[model samples]
Target: MAHLLHIDSSPRGDRSHSRRLTREFVEAWQQTHPADTVTYRDVGRQPVPHVDEPWIVAAYAPPEQRTPELWEAIRVSDQLIDELIAADILVIGLPMYNFSVPSTFKAYLDQIVRVGRTFAIDPEDAEDPYKPLLLGKKMFVITARGSSGFGPGERYGHMNHQDPYLRVAFGFIGITDITFVHVENDEHSSESLAASIAAAQAQVAQLVAA
Candidate 1:
């Protein structure tokens, strides 16, 4: 059975749309795939440490050349990477803040996106030096936004950074098969928010069945 990694990055507890949707998605997923296993991470409540100078040094250095101190510096990074590598599917509850991901989620991304682990550089191939290591994985992002119009050619499309940034970051590690479900209009009228939530929940249901 497939293994799923469920991650929630919304600081708001029960009030967060993203968190609620992700929980619903996972519960539905488990119902269908009874044998499947799930691993959960809550970066919003317990944020991962941001990468520091020692982390940089440790990441860049070859495994054989790294000292005990260097290994210690990247211990948490290694654990995060291990969890990512072990999972076949990922479901992230992301809330947009100022048109981008929250700082805590960004920190989680920084911890897992590592060279020689998630990706590699090949000096021999000048045309394609960057190589993605993680493969055969799927990702589902449940994003909650304050307002709508983040789609392409929409009113605020030009100001949207969340989707593109996540695509590039996750694609860099070979997770190109990604799907996004958005719950928008949080700051708008209750009816608008309700409609968005209904659409998002429908999409989530479809995805789980697929």
Candidate 2:
């Protein structure tokens, strides 16, 4: 059975479009693949601590040379990386904040993208020093935005840092097989929101079935 790591980074809970869409996606996926297991994390509601100086040292230090204190500093990082490595598929709910991801999700990224764990940084090879370790994993990101026209060549496309940032960030860790399902116009009129939701639902169904 496939394993899924389901993460929701929306503070709005029930009112969050990304949250609802991700739930629907996972539910539909479960119905199709009943034996699949899911691990859930809500970083938006219960935020994780940001990386500190000690965390920085712990991440770059050699595993064999790390002291007990250094290990303690990266305990959460270790756990998060372990969970990430264990998952075959990742379904993340992302709500755009100021044209980017929430701080909570950023913190999660900082924790999981470890130097030696998720990737290897080699100063010797300046051309391709960073080698990603989390390979053969598929990612599906459901992004909710207040405004529309964030697609490529659109009016506000250049300002659309959310998905592009995500792609690069996750791609750096070897998860390049990523798909995005966007629900736009969240802060617009009721009709617009409903239409966005309906379109998102159809996309979710197709993605789950595929």
How far does residue 17 in candidate 2 sit from its true spot (Å)? 0.7
Give me candidate 1's TM-score against the actual structure: 0.99
The per-prediction tally of clashing pairs is 0, 0
What residue pairs clash in candidate 1, if any at all?
Answer: none
lDDT of each: 0.96, 0.94
Error of 1 at 108 (Å): 1.0
Model 2 accuracy (lDDT, Cα) = 0.94
Tens-digit lDDT string for candidate 1 (1-210): 999999999999999999999999999999999999999999999999999999999999999999999999999999999999999999999999999999999999999989999999999999999999999999999999999999999999999999889999999989999999999999999999999999999999999998
State how far residue 207 of model 2 sits from its true place (Å): 0.7
Which of the numbered candidates is closest to the native, going by highest lDDT?
Answer: 1
